[model samples]
Target: MSQISRGLENVFIKTTALTYIDGDNGILRYGGFDIDDLVEHTSFEEVIHLMLYGDLPTKVQLQRLKTSLNEAYEIPQQVIDTIYSLPRESDAIGMMETAFSALSSIYGEMWNKNTNKETAIKLIAKASTVTANVLRAKEGKKPVIPESSDSFARSFLSASFARTPTNDEVKAMDAALILYADHEVPASTTAALVTSSTLSDMYSCVVAALAALKGPLHGGAAEEAFKQFLEIGEPERTEEWFKKKILEEKSRLMGFGHRVYKTYDPRAKIFKRYAQKLSERSNEARKYFEIALKVEELGIEKFAEKHIYPNTDFFSGVVFYSLGFPVYMFTSLFALSRTLGWTAHVIEYVEDQHRLIRPRALYIGPLKREVIPIELRG
Candidate 1:
């Protein structure tokens, strides 16, 4: 029998031209455009347009996309109604899961309709609204509506915090969203594609993907990594804390490595910059950023020889925290950013002559035998 690639590591199931990652060189591309190029030149909405369409938009097209996003920013009435019924302190993730699952009724008979531009737009725009609102509700605040077509990054932050974000904060948020927009074929995107292969509604497909992202081994890493910094308590204490946990305690540090990239995560490089800038946003932010930097330097010095370097989650938690999101809401931000990728892949898989994404599993068990009588003697 052939070898089983446990967890399908290094396995190729389908071909996608959506996004590309060269782990060895630490490169990422979305729709064949270099990620860094997109970050420098494009807005988050522009990046979404690039992912949904095959090219950058003209002025008219970009404006239409922005207008559509502004229009779609409103959460459907039913989803909001459901949110209002939940306890103010309810889980942000659960709120998102339940709210998205309610989409089948919003579009009514979505399984028959393959993913299109509107489907993509609604998910991308509403994800920001829904994620921000859930956090607001948890904070015992009213849901803030997004009003502008131009600056979603600013809109989301202002709405969620009930205060306008400074220019630096908006730029940081935009960069963070762009950095996280997509990553070729991740576990969650694959799960979404698998669901889409069955011709399931986009709602069900995205929810399945979100469930995969919720795993602590995946999307939950950022939240845990942030908490680790808090636990370490102070920047000067980072080395001692790391030693106590890694040497004496023999524990796993949350944010230092990734499965795909041996080199430092490219996103981490960008986020670390934002984290540094955001650290200056407030005194508390500065302290956390210092701790994050200390942990990174110590971790790389210790583990880089083994190709275990900082991954995206390493600084993402600090960046998000500096932006005023709660630790628990970290993954919600991840999910919102990643839904663009998921929505894109769903469209590509459904349109590209996809197949059911099941693979054969090896079974190692005793051969079938006849059942013994009720009381078989030993």
Candidate 2:
């Protein structure tokens, strides 16, 4: 047998044209456009169109896509009720998973052998609605339905926070969403793809992705990274905290490494700029940014030799926090942005002569062991 690749590290599954990553060189591109260029030049809606349709939208196409997404933002009443019924202490991402599962029942017609762009748009739009309402229900606030006039990023932020956001805030949030829109195939995307390979409905595939993303090592990393900044408290204390917590105590840091990126994550670079820009407007945000910078400096000093540097989760928490998101809602925000990628991959895989993503496990236990009766086994 070939040497087992634990965790399937560096394993190639299938081809995709959606997103590309040159991890060794710290490059990311959606379709064929570089992420940095996209973040600077495109709206979240535009990136969604690019990912789903395989090209940037013209003015008319972009408006139609926006209208479709805006119209789809109102989730089913039953899904909202389901969100409210969950315990207040329920994990936010988990609540989203449950909500999407409930959404699948209402859109039962979507359960077919093949998925399409319309289904992808609906799931992408409703992901934000479900996530916003989940956070609102947790805070004992009523859900806010988005107006059709609102832009995609604005709709999510307004609905999530129950207030209108400033233009700068909307721009920052849009960039954040675009930066997180897709990343080739991470754990969550792979989870979605695997479920899609089984000819599952899009909603069920999203639920599966959410389940995988809830782990600390995956989508949950941003929340954990924010907690670290809060724990550090003061910028001045970062070095001592790093020494005690990370050096002497040998504690693992949450946000500084990636499985693929050998240098700084390209998304992290974009997020860091946003974090710095947003930090200037809020004292609390500034403090977190300062502490994050210090931590990044110290971390790079220690680990740069090995090519481990800040991943997307590093400064992303600070950006989310600055944008008025609670720490708990970080991963759900990830799910919202990633919905496009998940559905895109699903559509691509199913359309490209789909195959079940089943792999074999090497058996190591006693070969050909004979089963004994319960009475004799003892």
- Model 1 CA lDDT for position 189: 85
Q: Model 1, residue 370: what's the lDDT?
A: 83
Tens digits of per-residue lDDT, candidate 2, 1-378, equal: 577887778998878888889989998999999998998898999999998889999999999999999888888788899999999999999899889889887774544434488888988888888988988999999977666654899888888887889998999999989988888788998998899888888888889999999999999999998899999999999999999998999887889888899999999999999999998989999999999999999999998998889999999999999998889999998888999888888888888758998888888988887789999987
Instruction: Tell me the spans in candidate 2 whose CA falls farther than 4 Å from its real position.
Output: 110-115
What tens digits encode model 1's per-residue C-alpha lDDT throughout 19-104? 88888889888888887788788888888888888788888999998888888887777787787679877777888888888865
What does the lDDT come to for candidate 2? 0.88
**Candidate 2, poorest ten consecutive residues by summed lDDT:** 106-115
Native-to-model Cα distance after best TM-score fit, residue 255 in candidate 1, in Å: 1.4
TM, every model: 0.94, 0.97
lDDT of each: 0.83, 0.88
Pairing residues by index, what is the TM-score of model 2?
0.97
Report model 1's TM-score to 2 decimal places: 0.94
Stretch of 10 with least lDDT, candidate 1 = 107-116
